[model samples]
Target: MTSVKSSAKAFVSEGALSEIVVKIMDDSVVEFLVGLGFVAVPGKEKETLSLIAPNQEFKVEVFSRLRDEGICFSVGPDWCPAEVFEFLRDQKKLTGFYRKIVWEGTSTPKIIENC
Candidate 1:
């Protein structure tokens, strides 16, 4: 049997690392998601916030895209509560992508931003 540490090392060496940590300034991503009309789930201790999908279609699309990108995420049917559809329908915010600068560097980077 393989040791757990060896297994983890092999996983990392295979470029199959399953998780990533992103540091966003000022919890802006959470704020943006909330501002976009996503309902925030409570009781998180980290800077990250759990958001509920407004409907089944939205949840399916998000999960599909994330799976296609090979990103790991967690979810359950409860993520789309019964009242979420009505809540989303009444929201004034539009559903779409909006780019926000989450990080800034004091010096120039070796890699080009476009790249």
Candidate 2:
């Protein structure tokens, strides 16, 4: 696994409740995923996107910011199963990391100012 220092990619879906993918360019750190919402793994060509694909690391970031209440529902039926969120709050990935959520909500999407 790459050093956390090297884990810099981040992204965000463009539509309302759209997916958020982040790529941390080696060019910068604090500017990568900082306050941008979440970080996602780099796409094949750097910007490629996969719908309903969540970045395990990004979810960890959300947990840190969100209340222990946790997300009331799974990110997506396909990307996230009930078992996942059930373990999200008190459970940590066996790989010693957090799961990222890159899926859209169960509804139509338009745009969000902050997303």
Candidate 3:
């Protein structure tokens, strides 16, 4: 008899923004989020991710929600370069808002006050 090793595959929802909140879960989930256009922001202990809205209208809609919830984030023009912004705009990948969320503290990620 031969013994074989098996690995469990992490399940991720395609094109789901909530999926990106699991960045602290594991590398596989992180990879999946990245594939869906989530940009990883460098942090010390917390993991931050930003998603560029497809257009200005969509950006406003989402940004208003984030602001209401008091989540830590930055708009596109705040962090993105002009050239990159233009490129993403041309590709219809970004608008004026960058929806950024920071998960902080413990193994279980949770939304906390802005850092």
- As for model 1, its CA RMSD to the true structure in angstroms is 16.2
On TM-score, the candidate that comes out on top is 3
- Give lDDT per model, in order: 0.27, 0.33, 0.36
Q: How many residue pairs clash in each candidate?
A: 0, 21, 0
Compared with the true structure, the alpha-carbon lDDT of candidate 3 equals: 0.36
Off by over 4 Å in 3: 1-46, 72-115
Which stretches in model 2 have alpha-carbon errors above 4 Å?
1-55, 68-71, 74-76, 79-82, 87-115
Query: If scored against the real structure, what TM-score would every candidate get?
Result: 0.26, 0.24, 0.27
lDDT of 1 by residue, 26-110 (tens): 3434444344343332444334434344555555444333223222221113322212322333463223221111113463212
Instruction: List the pairs of residues colliding in candidate 1.
Output: none
User: Per-residue lDDT tens digits of candidate 3, residues 33-101?
Assistant: 455465665672324455666665555444344334333242123332223323445666544432233
